[model samples]
Target: MAAIQALQALAIDVMLPALGNISHDLGVTNPNHRQLAIGVFLICSGLGSLFPGSIADRFGRRPVVLTCLTIYVALSLGCSLVSDFTALLVMRGLMGLFVSGLMVMPMAIIRDRFSGDRMAKVQSLVTMTFMVVPMFAPTVGQGVMLVAGWRWIFAVMAMLASALLLWVWLRLPETLDPDNRQPIMPRVIVGNMAQVIRCRASTGYLLGAAVMQGVLFGWLNSSQQLLGEHFGAGEMFPLIFGGIALVMAGMNFINASIVERLGARRVSQTAVIVYILIAVAHLISLMRGEGLWVFVPFITASMCLVTFIGSNFASIALQPFSRTAGAASSIMAFSRLLIGALLGTVIGQVYDGTAIPLFIAMAIGGSLTLALVLYSEKGVLFRRLNPPPLKVKAG
Candidate 1:
């Protein structure tokens, strides 16, 4: 499952170090236009998620995921072979579309087996392993570029997908029970989605997740530019980016260890508050003309907080759906990716050769997420809707 989740990150982060090469080789001159490579993938991935969940709900998790992985592998190969930037973008979008199942099916599978704090713990653990990919992806990309060319990066991804495909085929059992299967009809899918949307807790947390994802996607789209253009990191970009990813991986592991005791609500809410505070501090540092030393740590810390919020909010939002986990996960993933991609593209376009826009966007995102959470909980804060098990003490 972690490997499946890492496919998405690998598709995005591994290309970071090679963006310049890609732009040059593909004749993409505008920096913002270069960002569309990532933006288009995210948007298509989100839109692609819209159907897979319902399909999974009707058919089964294993078949849907396997089919998607096959398509993803083919598309990755297509990307490797593409000669033009426009063709590559189309292939990337198609890759993202098929890869949407990689994002949605795993959550449904997890939900099939666990719920509440236990589910959050499992999700965090999976995310911890998934986060490890980003920690090394840029460095890997750089290595591939140094040895070969940028096109080989896609080739490597295709090989990796092939391996994961075999792993899933061998080890993963179909988690969707026969009793829970629904017909693959538009009206049924719409009704299931409507149930998810009408639930205030689900919709509220989904929006909150979307806001947090917007911040994340914005950072991703802008980070390479910020490090290279503003900080003049150049070759050190991958190493520095990997260091921040290391922090996020560590935080995800820590969240997994403690979430069962403290509860997802408390941990996530506290993390969002801390994220907002760090964003404010980051903005202030930028305003004061602080150097890279100050900026890196603050931004890195904000990213750590994002890990906390992401896993917890996702678990909370999907807590109410057992039979409808596929549809629910799809809805949440769609909102997060599509909205986040659009918002992140906007943020990336507003890049003024500084960290100000990214910081402002993060701050606003954190604040908005907090508001949505509060509203979802009826003005309550840090109260566990599902208390921890008796073996675990609430912190």
Candidate 2:
């Protein structure tokens, strides 16, 4: 389950080290315009996420995910053959469309088998496996670039997606219970999504997740440039980038261990408050003209804090509905990716060859997320509404 979801991460991160080469080969002269390569895919994925939930609900989890993976694998290979920037972005957008399943199905599948704090704990454990891909993806991309050209990076993505495709086909059972299946009509999908959106707690957590996602996407949009050019890490960029991912992976592991005891709301809410404070400290250092060494700790700390939020937020948002889990997960994923795309594009475009813009975006995102969380909880923070069930399954 985790490996399949990580395909979405690998798709983006594996191309990070090769963005410059893609731009040069495709005749994209403006550096900022290169970000479109990522922005377009993400926005299209967000837009496409709205459709798959109903389809999965109507059919079954295994078939929809398998078909999507087949399409994703095909698109990854096709991307390698693109001769121009326009063609590449078009392929990316298509890949994003099919690949939306990679983000939504896993959550819906988890929701199928677990709920409450137990669900959050299980989600964090899933995240621990998921985080490994991003940590090594840039390094893998960099390694491929050394022997081949940028196009082969897409070839590598194709191979990785294929492996996950094979694994899912052989091992994954349909987690969605037969009774929860909804019809494929547009009204059915829309109505289910509407119910999710109208719930105050779900809506607030969804919006907060969206804002926080924008902050993460903002980093992905420019991290290679920021670490390599702005900070002058040069060839060590992949290692530095991977280091931040390592911190996130470790935090997810911690969240898994502690979430069942401390409660997801309390742990995640405390993390958000700390995230905002770290962002403020980061901004202060940026104002002081500090170097990369000084900024790394603050940013790493911020990523650690955010690791607590994503899975927890999703678990909370989906807690209210069982029959519409697919639709609920889809809408939540859509909002996060779409809003993240827009905010990430702004952060990338406003680069100005400095880390100032990125940190500023972080501060604003943290504040916005807090406000949304407050709205979700009616201005209260860190209160756990659901206690762990006594006889939960231990998967």
Candidate 3:
């Protein structure tokens, strides 16, 4: 489940280090336009997320995911072979579409068995495993760039997806419930998805997560410029990128250890409050003309808080359903990718050779997230709406 999900991360992060190479080699003249690669993929990903869940709900999860992975692998190779920048973006969009199955199927499978804080705990573990890709993807991309052209990065992605396809085909068991087989009919798909949007908790958390995702995407769209140029990290870009990801992964590990006991509400809520404070501090430091060391800690800390916020929010959003979990996850992923990509593009396009835009996104996103969550809970915070999961003994 984790590895399949990490394919999305690998797709995004691994290409980041090569954005400059891609832009130059592809004859992209404007620096800001390089982020179009990310924007296109993400926007298509959002659009694509709307369907894979419903499709998998109609079909079996295993067949849908295996089919998508095969397409993903093919598209990666096609992306490598593309000469025109427009063609590359087109192929990247298709890659995102195919990979949406990988993104949604795992969540649907997980929701097959768990809910509440137990679901949050499991999500944290999955996220921890997922974070390993972000931690190393840039470094891997950099290494690949050293040995060959940027197109080979896509080649590498194809190879990795092929391996994952083989692994899933051999080992992954079907987890979709026999009784919960949803139909692919248009009205049924709409009705199932409508439930997710109608639930205040699910809708609120999904919107909040979309805000947070935009903040993360803003950084990704401009990190090469912000870290390597603005902060003068130079060749240390991958190390710094990898380091922040390690912090995010570590926090997810912590979340996994304590979420069931502390409750997902408390831990994630506290993290949000702290995230707001860190964003505020980060903005203040930027005004003071602080250097890279001062900048890194505050930004990294804010990102660390996201690890706490993201998965817990997801578990809460999906808590209201079991049979329709695919619909819920699809809507959430759609908001995060589609809305977030547009917002991030705005931030990236406005980049003025500084970290200011990214931090501003963080501050606004954290504040807005707090507001949405508050409204979702009737102004309540940090209290569980569900009781702890009952312990089960082995049969």
Candidate 4:
């Protein structure tokens, strides 16, 4: 499941180093236009997941995942073959549609097996594993670029999808029970989604998660430009990008270890507070004309906090639903991707050869996240809905 999720990271991060080449080869002259590749993929991926979640709940996890993987592979191949930018974007949108299944099914499977703190722990572990891909994907892209062209990157993705398809076909079992199968109908999906929204905690946390995800996406859409254009990092881009991802991965691992004890609420809420502080500091530093030394670390810390918040938020939001896991996952994913993609595109487009816009976006996103979390919890904070298991005293 971690490997399957990593495919999404790989598709995005691994292509970072090749964006310039892609723009040059595809005749994209405007620098801002190049970001469409990432933006379109995210939008399509979010929209595409809308139905797959319902389908997964109704049919089964394994079949839905396998079918989507097949489509992802085919689309990857199509992306590789497309010569025009418009055609490539169309293919990317389709690829994202299928890739949405890769995301939703795994969470449904996890939700089927665990809940509360244990579920959060499992999610953290999976996220830690998933983070490994982004940490190295840029380096991998650069390495491939040294030997081949940008198109080979898509080919590599296709190959990876094909391998994962085989693995799932052979090994993954259908986790959705026959008795719990939801009917594939619009009314049922709407009802389940409405149920999720009516639960204040779920809705609030979902919105908070979406805002936090927007911060991450905004960074991603602008990272290459930020590092390469503003800081003149040049060939060091992949290394620096990977280093930041490594920090996030380490934080996720730590969160996985302590979440069982601290509870998702305490950990996530605390992280959001800290994240907001970091964002404020970042904005101040930007206004004060701080250089990369000050800017980079603050931004990196903010990103780590985002991971902490995201995992916990997701676990908390989905805690209330067992039967509606698929629909819940879909709604959450869609909201995050849609909002994140829009925020990211705006941040990318607003790049003015300076760091101010990015910092401003981060600050706003952080503030919104904090507000959403407070609203979700109804002014109460740091209290766990599901506390850790009590330890018995040894006689």
Please write out the lDDT profile of model 4 over residues 1-395, one tens digit for every residue.
79988988888899999999999999999988888899899888888877777888888888888888888888888988888899988988888876787777778888888889899999999999899898899999999899988899999998998999999989998887676789978899899888888899888899889887877888898899989778888988899899998999999999999999989999999998887787777788788787766767987898899888888898899888888788888888888887777878788889887888988887888888888888888989999776444343365
Where model 1 places Cα greater than 4 Å from the true spot, the runs are 387-395
Tens digits of per-residue lDDT, candidate 2, 113-183, equal: 88988899999989988998888999999999999988899998888888878888889999877778998
Worst 10 residues of 3 by lDDT: 386-395
lDDT of 3 by residue, 1-395 (tens): 89999998898999888998898889999999999999888888888988888887777689988998899899999999998889999998888876787888888888877888898999999999899998899999999999997889999999999999999999988877766789878999999999998888777788998988888888888988998888999889999999999988999999999998998889988888999888888888898798889888888898899999999998988888788888878888889888888888888899999888788888888999999889788899989777556454365
10 residues in a row with least lDDT, candidate 4: 386-395
lDDT of 3: 0.87
Q: Enumerate clash totals for all models, in the order shown.
A: 0, 0, 0, 0
Best by lDDT: 1
Model 1 TM: 0.97
Question: Cα lDDT of all candidates, in order?
Answer: 0.90, 0.88, 0.87, 0.86
Model 4 has an lDDT value of 0.86
Which digits, one per residue and each the tens of the lDDT, describe model 1 over residues 254-370? 999999899999999999999999899889888989777777888888999999999999999999888899999899889998888888888988998999999999999999999
Q: What is the Cα-based lDDT of residue 21 in candidate 1?
A: 89
CA-only RMSD, every prediction: 3.3, 2.0, 1.8, 3.4
The collision pairs in model 4 are none
TM-score of each: 0.97, 0.97, 0.97, 0.96
